[model samples]
Target chain A: MTVVDIPPPLPVRDRTALHERAPGALSPMLTRLAEERATGVLVREHGTLHLAEGRVVHAESPLAPGLDVLLTARGTLDAAAWPWTDDIPAATHRLLVAGLLPRGALELCRLGALYDAGYFALAPSSTPGRFRYGTTAAAGPPGAVRPLRAVPVTALERETLRRRELLHRIWPDPSADGAPLIRADPVAPPPVTPRQRAVLDRVDGVRTAPQIARELGRPAFHTLVDVRRLAAAGLLVPRNTVPPPPPLPPVTDPDIALLKRLRDALEAL
Target chain B: MPGIDECLLEAMRLPGARGAALVDWTSGLALGTVGEAPGGDHETTAAEAAELARLAAEHGAFSTADDTEVTPPVEDLIVSNRDSYHLLRFVVTSFDATVFLHLWLAREDGNLALARIRLGEMAERLVLG
Candidate 1:
């Protein structure tokens, strides 16, 4: 009998992730901000993150739903009772005085939305991210509700990495993350959980995962999970690799055609 | 469910309660925390607990008929050791709330049955935006 030793391809655990993939290493600007204790907004092409004293106060992205959508979807915020703007602090104070909303609940919602969108905001990008110090009117009406305790930038980055790792484990293909989903023609479709079925029902071949998440008021990452699983089950049109564009029609060079015809005519002459 | 802080504070009032937190299982993010953490770190404890919660919530073996679109399949889970116990109860809300209340209590002094009952009530009343 021979004893053979084999090594795993890659250790996909969180601990290994910490050492192998440095948190926020992809975005050096955020680390620099934390060192300076800078208070301002970090803007990228895809999204923006608000920071106060180097901690993440708020974050928003076009790719993920905002706090208002999540709040409305949960049916907790009464627009009349709690009219809110960017100033989370101010809006929260008003709601507290009105005795309509709990500060803790609002904070938690903001936190969830913060991380949800923050994940997209901190994604690796082609362009350099810009940072502006000092609060702007856009930061919130001077009294916008900020999270009671700001989350460390590093922590948010770490969590974002963890989410990406989890999604990759579920399905390695990255196409479904952005592609408009269409059902696959499986001989027999696999069954999905009630929650996943809801996700599948919204597969209109026009809406991507993020759009579906906004419509459903679910966290975008969860929606991605369902999409990946659905893809693995042959429920979604699996684009294993990015499909190449169709070939262009042959160009008609009239001069060459006329030249060849002229040469033939001369030879006949 | 009760707002994050309030629910955690309520759990702390229970006998032998050491620490409590409201965590989102899917994202493994701790919404809020109170008292002392089992591992002396709230964030790490929440993430670790979320792992167990996700397992119970997603697996087919522990799934019950009571499971519905909005309701989580497993009501709660209990893990006990020599000197402590961890109680996790899933919360149901209008939206797909993938959150649970985690309570770490002293083994000898904690009332397991009472904590479980109260944790369930807290989870039921928990309100999230």
Candidate 2:
């Protein structure tokens, strides 16, 4: 008799019970999947994450436009010639055969899109949706699908934190993150860097950071940082209707002495 | 012919290579990294290097005579300390010249001239689609 080997069957769960889990439960579910070394697609309400051996190899979300759109935006791929499909390997091979880009460039763009969309996918939304773990060959939703080098879950989480911190450092106000970019007067035009100028040119007072990023064929995170910096520089129109208060004047020596005396007097009282 | 990872690995193969990273200067993000970081943290190192690159790329004083416009004026920057040398080689892409390769080398064994030539060639050949 000849011996043969067969892979084990995948675990399956109905969709009805998936939503029964508590809202904002993706972190824990992802942790569980990572622990099991699960290989499949994790489809959430906002987007989908493709995993291989418990590592995220690709991700897609409406918030972050797909690689095809980005390439088209850059004029590398003619919009009419671009291929639209959910099959990542096929699309990748098609792009490669057309001599549109090098293998490394494709890999970089895939990783960039994965991280960009991953940030939004893992974000805390108003309502958390269900997740389905399909077989290893399962395809993601109909959107931009590109293959990426598998990234560990821990690294993705760390990168997300880093991006959040980078945004906060540039401008603390999170309200402007998704808001439209409007031109405004800054007393005098603030000195702008070349990159910021490029971003400013794209600002039409209608598109949000992510949208502008898609149009410019740049990473969404990079666009967010530029918008925040422009806001901080007083270049973009303020998100709030009311203007910010004028900066306080520098305190003189007399003011410091006065403050010290007031503190001493309060202590004595 | 080389991918980002392979390029970084090639950089590390250089004499006295300590660490290497492919960074997007605009966003201060590391696309990929290899070996140990000089500042003990790759993120911090990348951010700091990006700041330097931005400053050099923006300043008019660094602009070349042939190029009156301030379009990514500087091609590369080299900073040397007592123990190590930091090289920031700008890579021009079809879309934007916002990416660069950062390599940290120990002074004792590193050849600054050879490293500079190799990085320049790598930058010219880099393809980010």
Candidate 3:
């Protein structure tokens, strides 16, 4: 006789208590999920991370290009892989069955894009993250494309930290990240490389680093590096917003309850 | 035809292979790794190796004449210090060619010539899916 063991369900009450403690709790939230060996989608302000049994299966962010964009941009994907990509599993299945991509192309490309988005998804922000428990990320088999590789949360966090340090080492100031850059020092040329030139040419005082990355079909972190380098070279204008997020005072809001009371009294009058 | 683990294991079959890892040079993420790591940690080694790989692949001086294709500019980089030989061979894929195979071997026991040739072959056939 064969006995199949079922995984335990996610504890609902414990997670409900976590919501009140959030608003800047992505790290702790991910740690809790890892401890639970839970399966679900972690939805955040900047992106979403799909977790499967304590591992990060997929991460998506607006700052990073999607797998479709990366594939279509390369022009190497078959026509079938393009439209059918609406559903990841089906698209991967077709790509594999059709022998369109090599054995690991889909997985590699997805992993590349996954790291890009994962970095942004794990960025320290003031917004809270919400984890909805489910099995969407756990449906894939060993070699399925939907869940290419199950990355340990510890590994993901470490990689993300390394990337952050790399970016910091490249250019300390992060104003170029979200701010439009201008050609600040045009008189003296800094002798930019061809790749840096490609990134610089996109700088029109309108597009930010992420926008430039999207335009060039490159990772946003790479663009951030280039932007920071350009800024360091005294070529691009830096935004005034350079300081990191500081502790904020209590939010001030109008007395809506008193206003409603006054209105009710006026109506009675 | 070999997956990440199988390919790394094949690299380990080399005479003096100490460790091997498949790293994405662009994002500095190790797709898979086997055997020992250079600094006793694969993540740090992968990051440092990626910095070197990116230094080669990103510059115009090292770029190949062929600009039409999406392949990386440099093929592989061989770095040898006091005792060991580090080989980083770029893996050209359908989407992007930012991935590379990193093999660590002792200079005395390792065969650089044979390892480079075998690593090149492994990079060509490595399947990550």
User: Arrange candidates by DockQ, highest first: which order?
Assistant: 2, 3, 1
Q: Which stretches of candidate 2 lie over 4 Å from their true place?
A: A1-26, A88-90, A96-100, A136-148, A238-269, B59-71
C-alpha DockQ of every model: 0.24, 0.29, 0.28
Q: Per-residue CA lDDT of candidate 3, range A1-79, in tens?
A: 9988897997666655564664334488898898899888898878888888888878889898777767776576744
What TM-score would candidate 1 get against the native? 0.77
- Each candidate structure's TM-score, on Cα atoms with residue i matched to residue i, is 0.77, 0.77, 0.78
Query: Candidate 3, clashing residue pairs?
Result: A104-B129
Worst 10 residues of 2 chain B by lDDT: B64-73
Interface RMSD of candidate 1, in Å, is: 3.7
State, as a TM-score between 0 and 1, how close model 2 is to the true structure.
0.77
For model 3, how does the per-residue alpha-carbon lDDT over B1-129 read when each residue is reduced to its tens digit? Answer: 345777889999998899999897766789888999988999889988998998887777788777533567688999998999999999887654378999999989999999999998888777433
Q: Which run of 10 residues does model 3 chain A get worst, by summed lDDT? A: A138-147
Candidate 1's residue-wise lDDT over A1-269, tens digit each?
Answer: 98787876885646556556554454777888887888888998778888888888788888888766776775666545546576654555466455465555555666787888888897778899999897623233434343255688888888888788878888988789888898887898866777788888998778899998998888787788889989999898634345678897664899977988899999999
Best by lDDT: 1
Question: What value does the lDDT take at residue A77 in candidate 3?
Answer: 71
- lDDT (10s digit) by residue, model 1, range B1-129: 245777789889999999999999887888888999987989889878998998888776787766666666788999999999999998776544588899999999999999999998877656532
